[model samples]
Target chain A: MVKLTEEMKTAFSKVKIFPVATASKEGVPNVVPIGFCQLVDDETIWIADNFMVKSLANLEENPNVAIYVWGPETGGCFQIKGKATIISSGEKFDKMKAIVNAAKPGLPAKTLIEVMISDVFQCAPGPEAGKKLL
Target chain B: MVKLTEEMKTAFSKVKIFPVATASKEGVPNVVPIGFCQLVDDETIWIADNFMVKSLANLEENPNVAIYVWGPETGGCFQIKGKATIISSGEKFDKMKAIVNAAKPGLPAKTLIEVMISDVFQCAPGPEAGKKLL
Candidate 1:
């Protein structure tokens, strides 16, 4: 299990949108901007599936996923790669549904995606860019 | 070949950063934020490799790529999926090298990645979200 540093958590919290990427078993890639992603803990992230179609399909085919978090104002970028599990009905799903409903009423929180982070990478443009952080 | 709509072009132009996703042939995923990306044409996008390591390695193994662009102020999001070609030393590479140099001096424009867009999807949070736009 990988642990997220305090700097990484702070940067992720500041991001308004998270771009989540997933690949099918055939290697075709899909990316989507998610507005309802929360860092549940250092090693876990919860993404509320509001309108995810291709991403969900890709996840079903291949559990591997990558999430990019960047602060537009701060210019901090990080990539979190991990395995994702789709929770349709569970306590975590219920909690995520409540959060999503409170944030945007009438939207269906179909599934709550739990990502178990295995690696983290720095995405900022510099010498250490793309270097594994965890 | 696919054509980009005027709305898509405008939204992409307004984005300050582009998050690009790529997967290895084994389906391992990598994502990175790129600051030097430009739309070359309706169906082609150019990304300058400033500080890419895993992303470039993933591209070499699998050409498939996905790019996510979102406007912070307008909240417009689009996902562009395509096949990428890395140009190390060529006319396109030279041109991209010039652009990258102008944008950020001393940064290595190691390669110019040309993405041939195959599909475009709407990523806004609504009923039409995740719908095919092109």
Candidate 2:
């Protein structure tokens, strides 16, 4: 089991948004910007949204997802995947919203998509990853 | 449906490899380095290998996949998804191999994974994507 440190949380928290990749049964995929993800513990990250996009619908059918978070520089790429457990209305959703609001003030409130993270991995520098391949 | 460009083909062809993301029915995920992917016309990308891993097995059960390609800069992230059409030992397989060999030489031969693309999208700069969310 991988653990998320404060550094990882800080790295993820500083960013206002991340791109989520989702797909449907027919194999059509959608990527969009999401404004909320919170560190639920050392092993969980949450996302909140209620858009009826392909990505959201895809999650209802298939919960598998990959989130890409890249920094201003080329080296920071955080790719995370796990089951997207839909907590539409519950205490968990409320807690997640509070976290988001506290982290990012003045943002509008919306539905939430929480990802119970199973694994998180960071990519090395581009040249390093390429060299390892070759 | 978006079409692939010769420039996109050239951009993908030069690379010797790209990382693949896979997950099991239980929701555990994995990411690995794979050295095979070929542009099949304008809407398909083929990957080959015979590793009995989560990504492959995930495809066997659930063929939904998302591929991320990022350049070594502030931009250049091509996120694509579609069905994984497995074409083993046939005319399509042979054609894909030839393309791979021509694009990259002296590489080891392996099984192929074909992605029948349905949608393709490009990400703008980090600030631009961030602003759209805020």
Candidate 3:
């Protein structure tokens, strides 16, 4: 597993929304927009599971997740792939709950998904597109 | 399959960049930022394959695709899922090439992916999140 670079972290932070992609055990792909993903550390990211359905179901079967970090203000582009662990308890879970509740009191923020980064790919236009960066 | 609503078309047009997700035959999920996806018609869309690798390969193995549409100005959020057909020659292909070449003459715009939308799902962060609309 590779750690996300400082540049990648900064670009990720500027993103307003990104897509999280997952696949079921049957190899069926599912994707949804995510707005509560946080860069927890150089090697980990946290996503609040407020209203996931197929995305959560896919994760239950296949732990790997792919997130595309690109928006008008993201500065640059990249893709993050990692193995996700669904956390329903413990310290990180509690912190995630607090953060979501602070922003919107009614958001369930039911669980926290902790993703340990394994790969990062350049998604910027031109020759570097799809090149592995980490 | 269902046709896209006029409202969906309007919102889809506002997105500058969106995420296109695909999976290998073995179900390994992959996602990348897309800037060339077009709402060709109510039930169809097109994506130019200017720079692609794993994404195109995955589509060859499994044509199903998922695209998340959401940006600062998109007005609404939704996910489009469909079967993708890679077009390398003929009418749509020629049109796609012309559009790409006109915008940037040097771009290869190698192929055109015609997506026949089979489903639409709300992704506006509510009880309707992931609820299929079409």
Classify candidate 2 by CAPRI docking class.
incorrect
Q: Would you list the clashing residue pairs of candidate 2?
A: A47-A113, A48-A112, A48-A113, A49-A111, A49-A112, B47-B113, B48-B111, B48-B112, B49-B111
Please compute DockQ, using alpha carbons, for every candidate against the native two-chain complex.
0.80, 0.10, 0.76
lDDT of 1 by residue, B1-134 (tens): 69898878888889887878999998888887787888999999999997889889999989999998787554577788899999999799999999988878899999999999999888777789778888
What is the C-alpha local distance difference test score of each model? 0.87, 0.58, 0.88
DockQ for candidate 1, C-alpha atoms: 0.80
Candidate 1 Cα misplacement greater than 4 A, ranges: A73-75, B73-75
Candidate 3's displacement at residue B31, Å, is 1.5
Candidate 1 per-residue lDDT, tens place, A1-134, comes to: 69898888888888887878999999888888888988899999999998889889989989999988777564577788999999999788999999989988999999999999999888777899888889
Name the top DockQ candidate.
Answer: 1
| Residue-by-residue lDDT tens digits, candidate 2, A32-106 | 555565667776677766333455677788787766455554335556666787776788878766775787665
Summing lDDT over every window of 10 consecutive residues in candidate 1 chain A, give the lowest-scoring window.
A69-78
Report clash pairs, candidate 1: none
B-chain TM-score for every candidate: 0.95, 0.70, 0.96
